[model samples]
Target: MKSSTMLKAATAVLALAAPAAAQDVTLRIQTHYNPEQTSGKLATEFVEDVEAMSGGAIDIEMFYASSVVATVETFDAAANGILDCDMTGGAYQTGKNPAFQFVGDIMGGYDTPYQQLSWLYYGGGKEQAQDLYNQFGMELIGWWVYGQESLTSTTPVAGPDDLKEWKFRSPPGMETEIFANLGASPIVMDFTEVFTAMETGIIEGTDYSGLANNQSIGLFDLAQHATYPGFHSMPSDHLACNKMVWDGLSDQHKRIIETAMEKLALRSALFFEKANAEAAAELAEKGVTLHNWSAEDRATFRKAAQAAWDDWATRSPEAAALVESHKSYLTQLGLISQSE
Candidate 1:
């Protein structure tokens, strides 16, 4: 009888262990940020939060700096099951669809990170973004609007007129067109090439990362003039997963993943805000002349950006719909006049 009792006890223990083992789900994620970058740290925090929240039911293995795939190919990689998730900017997909330009980088549409995040969560922007991702066979989990990007130049850029005849590196699509409108010669180059190009005088400046990130990379050592509270681009970084993989997740696991992403987004915005401010002070002490354009000057740049918006909207129905959604929201919020 004692022998029988031992067998039963062992069976019960094995049964409990079986369910625990079956609960594990591992997701492989790729990101565009290096492990030491601010966004990269946020990615690491997100993995820890999801693991803890799910009680060990979910695991995220991250590949940093586009290690798993090229930056622009992340969407296709996730869609094809090469990676389970992609933590990168959506604007990289502009070659696939012009609509991504509107989704990824709205150019001068938003003056701050919070405004863009507000629109994404509460102003119907999320649903519209999902529509775009759905067409590509991926699910839009969440996104982060890190901070405004600054222009680093050898010369002061106080107004749109200052851009005239200047040579600089600008990302593709809207930015390239917008700068051209202001009479600046825009060069399209990879982010990795910016430093060397600047060092050799191949380019006069670059509209690169946030103030803190630019400072971290020592851009100020070469370019004396830096723009603060940047007036132009605020690129939105996204977290997306394969549609089939996402659909297969249990409702509880899905919620945990989504919650983790939302938490990361807010944390990233707040972190960049503080980091950029502190970095600006440090740069000033280092002899960098920081320029914050006047409100009038900002309005002038915004007017020029409007043309890029109109041009993008005419690319396709999807592109047109995305532009309309942004205009409607901005108009309702009094950010842009209805006549605009």
Candidate 2:
């Protein structure tokens, strides 16, 4: 071979090799959960799993405790590609898109964790939710439930009447409406603000996760009174990815992410259950009293909550259908009463 021709071939080979060697991509994973908390741990684990699964072809940089973005801002950040992933509540973004409220609006009807999980993954619930998200230019990658949330307050609450004269911290939409129906003054604020608000008495009480999560944040320390059976959030927590980023991944990468999420979901559900149980015991040790609602009192509260739901449903046909669908599902499974 001529020396010039040989030199040209070597140069071409190096050029191709250089491009391959320089291939690098990084994804930012954001969430409001504390980095040391279960949700944050799982998120970080998912990032690691993604890195491992992709063999370092894709690097995920995780930002927790809303460092990169606040919980309420996650949806917009992810949709706009400011962040590549987020574990957030679909309903918190209701101001951006009403359809996100569909999740929170009908969550009251899920009787069990298994039921909610089934409905979300295999029962076409996720697809419908994804359709809603896609409209906002994001995708619903995967979601997990962290069980129900109950009220933690400075004063013990056994009935709706007890809720009066209390300012309760609540999320937007249905939750606010529910609190209003119970006669509690609703305080709308982001989750991060709840701790400080409670500490400074900006709010008298807040509806947060089960015992363990609250304990981690010292929420139980601020409010010694805890109520059982959070009718509002029969289930809580969500995990999502940016739509464009999700679609841009290879099929194999998508499968890895989804599978990792499923495993993480199962782990998280169990973790939440165990944590709440343990936290209940710890609360007693720490002088926090747990109050379970009496049958009549619960019935009364439910009736009032139902009234609120009815009012909301009447205001939005889509919300009404979601509530009815979940109700029908529960009725068919004998988890709830078919009558009224």
**Could you give me the TM-score of model 1 versus the true structure?**
0.92
Window of ten residues with lowest summed lDDT in model 2? 104-113
The TM-scores, one per candidate, come to 0.92, 0.82
Score candidate 2 by lDDT: 0.73
lDDT by residue for model 2 over 1-340, one digit each (tens)?
6999999999999888863332346878777777787888877887787778778877878788888777789878887888887677777776755545666445455645677877777666776676666777887777677777778998877677788868978866776777676778998887779878888888888877776777777787689888765555764457677777887777766777788778777877788888888888878887988887776776666566666656666655555665566556666666567675
How many residue pairs clash (N, CA or C atoms closer than 3 angstroms) in each of the candidate models, in the order given?
A: 0, 0
**Model 1 worst lDDT run, 10 consecutive residues:** 15-24
Candidate 1, superposed: residue stretches over 4 Å from native: 1-22
lDDT of 1 by residue, 122-155 (tens): 8899898899999989999988888899999988
